[model samples]
Target: MKNSDQTFSLQDISPKGLERSRKLTHLISSEIGATRQQVIPFDRFMSLALYADSLGYYVAGQEIFGAKGDFVTAPESGDLFGFCIAEQCAEILDENDVAITEFGAGTGALADTIIRYFDGKISVDNFNYSIIEPSPHLSQRQKIRLSKINSRLADKIKWYTTCPSEGFFGVAIANEVFDAMPAKRFTIQRGEIKELGVAYDGENFIWEIIECSVIPELIRDQMSNYPEGYTTEHVETQGIWFEQFKKFMKRGILLVADYGYVNQDFFHLDRCDGTLRCYFKHHLNDNPFFAVGLQDITTSVNFSYLAECALSAGFAVDGFTSQAKFLIGNKLGDHIATLSVGDSVDAYRVAQEAKRLILPSQMGESFKFMACSYRLEKNMSGFADNERFRLG
Candidate 1:
């Protein structure tokens, strides 16, 4: 396994940092083609930049989440977010012989929080929990955190670098994972489709157009009506990876939560720049070329495409809603109520953190939740009232 001796921090940027970026840039160029053949699809560049074994962003031992990291996910926001998810997981686990599989378990904060919520009830003897993480560095970090916080539960959770196999039953989840996967950036030009790729200009990385597999049939049909100059993006890897995750489920629900929009809004004419961005030290901006493997590169998910893909992959679309709505509907209020009369300091701190999660200006509206079920035929509490968005 690839392990780093130290975590990469923006505060640590130096001449050595430029050299690291230079090395990864050259590695990416080599992975795609020679500099003379400069054009490579955005996804290929992204894969190398973010997931290239020990040198990629995620596996390079970078502090990529929370206050000290590049960005803060819901779990890093506080324990309340995980509590809300745990409330739902509690229900899912009430069933007999089920395991929880999580993809991209960042920092293991959510897993730790959930285990605390469940107390000593969930054990490792039967392998009731598993995490699917390809980044050796992140997996090692997660192991250390889980072991430190709750060592006994560490054995209960198994880590797999690949998707689990067929005939498994459990709750499958991915928190902000789909967006992190490589995405192909494309734009409409002169009413024809063109793909955006990366190229090296001997000195710096540049964007170039390239020929790739046509956009998926589902996306093509959706974009046919858009005007020229329209720009948007899609994650081909997301669909394929979800299909692999779907394979192991004889019956269970896959809850995917990320920031994105439906087809209409995602490919809207005015969204010409697409939703690609790089995160470094909490600074959100475009230009993945800035830090190479030092920053987080992600795109807004296309939930419309996601919904269609789940159906095509042979799963039922269980529910869809904004994160705030899902959390509110799933008993976030109830959890907050329990904290309402706690110690003044703790209560106030908890309330403030909760606000950031549900407020419109925060993660509430921008981040969306999608639940797909395989063979399971029951409604989940998270989608109880605010499930206005559902598959036809």
Candidate 2:
């Protein structure tokens, strides 16, 4: 939020209105095994706070996943974004007849774009899509959106609360999904590392240092070089999730795009605080404890871990590149040209959105694209122009 241009009022943090704050607080304490004053690890607190049934941020009746929600995804930004992705997806599925499984399929706009593009071209009977969404509210919204776009396409798309039990083939995509997984927060304190946690003081939640244990080797490797007082976060969820997701894919590609860094860049020595952040309305706040369930709390991903996880889980690391390069390489120019901007105002707006998506100082450079393939060819349009290092 500090570096972002967007702003939101303190009042808007209450997504379900401030009335539900008590219910959220009560649910967190009950689900996380917290006594009246006992502390819970930050990761545990985050998991429970963001995902605890109907009481959590995503499920408990609030407008999320759009401009009306806390933040906007690239798909929602414009149809151009999803069209570019569909271009890549279409190329992958040209010969291979398979299902496209999308994790965190918010608003189903990407699916709409894919459907619109391949409507008459691809046989609807051969093509299928499954959205892995847990939130009933969001799923309902997706149904409405998909049906609005095209009822036939909606019929082809199925909603799954869990991964398909049978082995499947095709591409899997999760846009900005990994960053939402709960991460363990730790700080280098007095030459020793301490885990950051949360405790309720009857009136409010406060930060606390929970007992330390044998840290995950991944965390230790990165934190060892940081100076004392340096704070950071790490996640094992993507690796764990990949183990399950890959089971559904006998052969396909996994495309992950989110703002993240390689391990080396993630734990930069000069970074005093890791990339943990909260989004309420459009405003950014570093404190996850601020609005609890109402605000979205997330940390930047460590992409290096993802590649390692994919390899260990039997995926071949295919391509890794910046969002800008990926877009440029994947015919962003073509997609932009397809837009019909008649008026100067609309043209100017389109230009601004493209600039934000492709500019180095904006979302483009900060977000990265990683492709992990399973029994599929590695060379693809998304990474054709990934060679940014050679520019200098």
Q: Of the candidates shown, which would achieve the greatest TM-score relative to the real structure?
A: 2
lDDT of 1: 0.78
Candidate 1 residue spans exceeding 4 A from truth: 1-12, 32-36, 95-98, 120-127, 211-213, 339-342, 386-392
Model 1 Cα lDDT, one tens digit per residue, 164-183: 56466878889998898898
307-350 per-residue lDDT for model 2 (tens digits): 78888899987788889888887788877766745687767777
Measured against the true structure, the TM-scores of the candidates, in listed sequence, are 0.91, 0.92
- lDDT for 281 in candidate 2 is 78
Colliding residue pairs in candidate 2: 1-284
**CA lDDT of every candidate:** 0.78, 0.78
- The runs of at least 3 residues in candidate 2 whose Cα sits more than 4 Å from the true structure, single-residue gaps closed, are 1-16, 30-37, 95-98, 387-392
